[model samples]
Structure formats: C-alpha cells, structure tokens
Target: MSRIHKFVKDLAETRKTPKEIKTMVDTAFEVNSISQSQIYRISALVMAGRTLQTRRARTEKEGPYRRLY
Candidate 1:
C-alpha cells in the first residue's frame, strides 16, 4: 500500500474523526507530493472501513434498485 493508504488505515484503526481525517489529508496534499484526489480517495476508503475491492463487492450485491415515484 501507499504511504497515504497506510496513514489512513492507521488513523481509522484508531477511530479518528472525519474532521481530523480531512484536515490531515488536506495537509498531506498541500505539504507533500500527493494529489488532492488521491488524498480524498484514501480518506473515503478509510472512512468506509473496507478495502476498495470489498466495497465494490458489497455495492454490487446491494444493487441500485431504489423505490421511488
């Protein structure tokens, strides 16, 4: 995994808040070589508490069949 991924994983494992995670990710993108989109992606993954593969699998299982008028 990338350093950003590792950092986000560690933070999630410690139960970091979304605000804190956003601040850290923003700072990383501004002060480091990482891109903002990359940071956003990592933050989202951490918040979701699962790997991208797992998330995609779950979403596919759930489908997009919503009930509405």
Candidate 2:
C-alpha cells in the first residue's frame, strides 16, 4: 500500500480534525508523510498508464502467455 494511504488510514482511525491530523502525520513521518503535490503526481501517473493501455489495446489485446494458458 501507498505511504499516503497508510497516513490517511491513521488519520481516519484517530478521528482528528484536519489541522490535528496534519500535525500528527507530519510528526509521525518526520514532516514527509503526505502532500498535495505527491498525490497529484500519483494521479497523473495512473491516468497516463491507463491512456497507454488504451492506446495499446487495439493491436495487442492479450499478453504473450495467453496462448500457453
């Protein structure tokens, strides 16, 4: 699982306000747990991967091991 996911789960489990959560997570992770820029980067990578898969789906629809399976 992602570090950010763990951070969020901790936040939820603790049931703290936003300011409290941020301070606690930052403290727990030494000020490097989660951030908006990092989340945005992950989202961008996921979207790009999906686009790449769609682009490749037309001519190469199955994996190389499909026939063996």
Candidate 3:
C-alpha cells in the first residue's frame, strides 16, 4: 500500500485525532522527505473515502505510483 494509505489506515485503527494525525504527518514528512501537500491530500482521501488515484491525478502530473502525502 501507499504511504498515505498506510498512514491513514493506521490512524483509523488507532483512532487518532486530526491534530495527532497532522503532527504525525509533519514528523513523517521531515523524516521521510515527503511533501506536506501530499500528506494533506492523503488525509483528505482518508476522510472522504476518495480513491487514491483520483487524488494523485489531481495533485500531480506524474506517475500515480509515487507516494502522495
């Protein structure tokens, strides 16, 4: 699974709050070299039940396989 998907799934399984998720995401970005925008998009996907492909297409112009948030 994608990092975003894994992060969201973990958050859901752990019942993390948005604030907590945001903090975790921020830390993850700093450590993993991921973009903040991607993280935000991923969070949106998790919350809205949107497909990752759609979000990726909207967020980037390159391969959808790349990590998004």
Q: Candidate 2 residues 1-69, lDDT tens each?
A: 566554654454445455665666677678676775544433443444433244346436666634320
Poorly placed runs, candidate 1 (over 4 Å): 1-7, 31-49, 62-69
How would you encode candidate 3's per-residue C-alpha lDDT over 1-69 as one tens digit per residue? 667557755674466665676678667765644454555555666678766677656668665556634
lDDT winner between candidates 1 and 3: 1
Order of all candidates by lDDT, from best down to worst?
1, 3, 2
Global CA lDDT of candidate 1, please? 0.63
Rank by TM-score, highest first. Answer: 1, 3, 2
Candidate 2 vs candidate 3: the lDDT winner is: 3
**lDDT minimum window of 10 residues, candidate 2:** 44-53
lDDT at residue 12 of model 2 (Cα atoms): 46
TM-score per candidate, chains pooled: 0.45, 0.38, 0.41
How much is the lDDT of residue 38 in candidate 2?
A: 44
Which has the greatest TM-score? 1
